[model samples]
Target: MAALQTRALSKSYGSRLAVDRLDLEVERAELFGFLGPNGAGKTTTIRMALGLIAPTNGSVEILGLDVRRHRSEVLPRVGALVESPALYGYLSGRDNLRVIGSQLGRVSEKRIDEVLEIVGLKGRDRDRVRTYSMGMKQRLGLGIALLNNPELLILDEPANGLDPAGIVEMRDLLRNLAAEGKTVFISSHVLSEVQQICTRVAIINHGRLVRLAPVAELLQDGGEFEVKVDQPDELVAALKRQQWGGEARSEDGLVITAAPDGRGRSLIKFLVDNGFTPDAVSARHRDLEEIFLTLTEDPVK
Candidate 1:
């Protein structure tokens, strides 16, 4: 069963729709990224999935159990830290964990230590939360959420206040969680970090899902198809005549783009069939930031 699944999930406030027919799913042990710009309905969708808010038009399920019907049973297996984590400024990090763990029943002192170590806060476990750095508090919030040893972790902007080193630590921690068979679902606008940490990503823009693909596939950005043909000008004219958008450089030959749909090879075959000998063909890959911009900048269907 998918760790989490949303079918036609949607939310609206009066005339404004926050989410629109969102169909998404995450597999077990997958470090999944939910990406979107600010105000793109990421948090709204997460709230609906976690049963913190009701969807206007659809359903959400966790491990095949309906979130609405099995809230008690499903939520226990899920842990979440949304936006900025709330911490008790006065309480020691260790004591804070004890306070939260107390609600779930007799949380052993040993369990608190284990979580502190997991979050790399063991050295400062006794320090007041307010005295800790932004990175440390973020880790502590994550530790609090881990008190239950949840199977599915849903975090929104987990790296919000983290510095470079902290971000790296968060990334490694998430990878380690997934390694331990925990499904990690996160929402963020951080494209590069998402690319580095997540295996698969779903991009939503203006409350609509524009793309969903593996990190490697998304980064490939349709593969830059560059070739040096014997007749550069003729090649340019032929490509234009065929309605293929490509540019011809004076000294460098022709530069074209190929999506995963095999358009590049078709172009090559068309050139060969027309008796135009080509010197060579090569492909270049794009990074995640570039791809993210292209998706969000275009019109969504």
Candidate 2:
């Protein structure tokens, strides 16, 4: 069964449509990424999925339970950290978890210790939240979410304010969670982080889904081999004659729709066999930032 599913989910405020017939299916133990520009209704969709707000025309199902109808049953199995996490500065990290845990049910100290250790707060868990960094606070919030041993976790920009090292840690943490059979859904503007962490991604533009695919497949299609030559037009014509193995087009060089592997060597040999001697050749896989810009700029295909 899918860990989460949304069927023609939609929301509208007055005359403005926030989410337009969004449909998605996320499987169990998958690290799913949700991406979009600001005002693309990512938050609105999340809120509706969490049953914080009612959808105007559709439904959300988590763990095979309809969110609207099984609020009491569904919520306990799901954990979420939306926007910035809320923490009490006056209280210690341990106290914060205790307070949140107290509301849920009777939580043992061993469980508290385990959560604190899992989120990397064991050493400083007794410290006041005000003294903790943004990364620490985020982890603390995550610890609270894990208190119930949730099966599904929904995070909005979980790595928003972390440093490079913190980002890496968060990535590893998500991967470990998924390995442990926990489903993780993250929505973030940090394309690189999403690229590294998520197995599959869904991009929404103008409150509608524009693209959805595996991270590897999308990167493979987006990357190109830069074929530099002394004569651009002539070399391009020659490549056309050679029947380039992959889709080839001429711009700054031959933007072949393939990563430069052994094919790069073949391309160089092909160029050398022809009249043109290359100036420089380089291989570059289109990173998430470029792919994201291209997708967001152009109309959804």
Candidate 3:
């Protein structure tokens, strides 16, 4: 069964539609990425899924239970840290966990320690949250989310305020959580981070889903091959015979993406057979930033 599923889920505020006919499915133990620019309905969709707001149309299911009707049963199994970390300034890190723990019913100190260690806050658990750095506070928020050992975790921009080192730590932690069979749904504007950490991704733009696919496939579509040859014109001409030829260009002894398959060796061999000796060949996959720009830059009609 899918860990989470939504069918034509939509939300509208007055005349403006925040989310429109959004359909998505997250499999068990999968790290799913929800990506979009600001005001693209990513947050709105998440809010609806968490029952923080009602959808004007469609429905949501968590663990195969209807979100609206079975929230009591579903919510307990889900952990979420949306937008900012919610922490009491005066409460110590461990005390904050204690407070949340009380609501969840007598959580043991050992479990709190386990979560603190998982988020790399074991040593600072006794410090007041106000004294913590942004990254530390983020980890503490994550610890609170993990306090219940939830099956599904929804993190929105969990790396928003972190420096490079903190981002790396957060990435590793998410991977560890998924390895333990927990389903993670992460929403972020940082495309590179999502690409590195998620197995599959869904892109939303202007309140609509633009694309959803495996990370590899998405990169493959936008991949480019670099072919360095003695005769650029001949290689360019040869590539022009293929379907993707029109998309290829020649630049400074290098032929870029001018062939059906963006493979360098075949182009070099083609050149060698045709009386040209190519120096080097390489394949370059599109980075997450490029792919994201291509998908989101075009306006949603």
- Quick one: best TM-score, which candidate? 3
Put down candidate 2 lDDT per residue, 45-76, tens digits, no spaces.
Answer: 99999999999999999999999999889998
lDDT of 1 by residue, 1-301 (tens): 9999999988999999999999998999999999988888999998888899999998999988999999988987888888888999999999999998887677799889899988889999998999998888888989988888999999988898788887888899899999999999999878888989999999998788989999988876665566677777776666655534444333445645442345667757776887777787666567778888888885644
The whole-model C-alpha lDDT of candidate 1 against the native structure comes to: 0.85
Candidate 2 global TM-score: 0.85
**Candidate 3, pairs of clashing residues:** none
Every model's TM-score: 0.85, 0.85, 0.91
The deviation in Å at residue 235 for candidate 3 is 3.8
Give the Cα lDDT of each candidate.
0.85, 0.85, 0.87
Alpha carbon lDDT of residue 21, candidate 1?
94
Screening candidate 1 with a backbone cut-off below 3 angstroms (N, C-alpha, C), the clashing residue pairs are none
Poorly placed runs, candidate 2 (over 4 Å): 222-224, 228-233, 237-284, 298-301
When summed lDDT is taken over every stretch of 10 residues in candidate 2, the lowest stretch is: 253-262
* lDDT at position 22, candidate 3: 92
